[model samples]
Target: MDIPQVISKQAAETGEMGQEYLATGKQVSMRRWEQAASEFGETHCREYETVGMLISGILELDLDGQTATLGAGDSWLVPEGAPHRYRIVEAVVAIEATSPPARFNNRDEPTSGEA
Candidate 1:
């Protein structure tokens, strides 16, 4: 995918945390999450796969019935359609790459504040 170089794109506050996203065609996406403490109360099953590297703070993810606590120096992989939930142990920042582009999947359509 010929990903464009993001020069001055702004971040959109979509979730409890803020997010900046760059979609590369309909194949992949690059995303960054801002530092914010939050917990996804309900479980979610994502239809897209994701691989991410934690940048700062801490996060605890509950996948199926297992919980993994990730610190700043950790990398993670989540397969498609996995039931999971996450809580920010502290404010967190992460860089993630997703396949089956989230925008195309219609996962969280742009909200009023979304860019």
Candidate 2:
């Protein structure tokens, strides 16, 4: 049997924030979002690890209080439960790979004053 397949934004799980996995067991998902400078605040994932590559533009990342600016061709590993935040200095396209698959979804729209 063939595994399930989906395009980045066409998938049912995709939205303004991002996309997540529906079926469990080893899975992979990729998405791209264009962000403006200082448009988003910090985010942290407590359930899964993520590995990602910057496809284009520049990103400023704050990993547990340490800061780094990543550009195209750069990649990093984010362990579960680590607090992190990122903003795009220029329009950016990021490709992310998650392990154990991301089973959650952000269904609610962003609240006022929230990122």
Candidate 3:
């Protein structure tokens, strides 16, 4: 499958937004997001590796029991099966890439509650 690039200028200006960029086989998926004062629910990738780069603003990442704040030019790697969560404390954009593309069982649902 051919994956397209995702841009987030609109999300950046508006505060909070997310987009999926590319997916190759089941090997990887790339995503982008612009967040403003939002918290991402805790989750885990059962069989994938995740890596992310903070393009702008600040991100509070909680991996397992360890917590860290990442800002512009910062990056992180989350090994497979790690329970993690993140929060956006400021208007920010980030590029995230995952190997063995994270399978979101509820991607099409309005919310996890609806699934």
The whole-model lDDT of each prediction reads 0.73, 0.64, 0.67
Write the candidate numbers in order of decreasing TM-score. 1, 2, 3
> How many residue pairs clash per model?
0, 0, 1
Candidate 2 — which pairs collide?
A: none
Rank order (by lDDT, best first): 1, 3, 2
Candidate 2 Cα deviation (angstroms), residue 28: 3.8
Superposed on all Cα atoms, model 2 deviates from the true structure by an RMSD in Å of 4.3
Stronger candidate by lDDT (2 vs 3): 3
lDDT, candidate 2, 1-115, per-residue tens: 7776544444545555653333344454444555556654846544567788888999988788888899999998878667777878888877776664654353224433345
Winning candidate number (TM-score): 1
Whose lDDT is greatest here? 1
Angstrom error at residue 108, model 3:
9.3
lDDT: the better of candidates 1 and 3: 1
Model 1 misplaced stretches (Cα beyond 4 Å)? 1-3, 7-17, 109-115
The count of backbone overlaps in candidate 2 is 0
Q: Please, what are the lDDT tens digits per residue for candidate 1 over residues 15-99?
A: 3335677544567877778667877546777668988889999998888878999999898888887777778889988988888
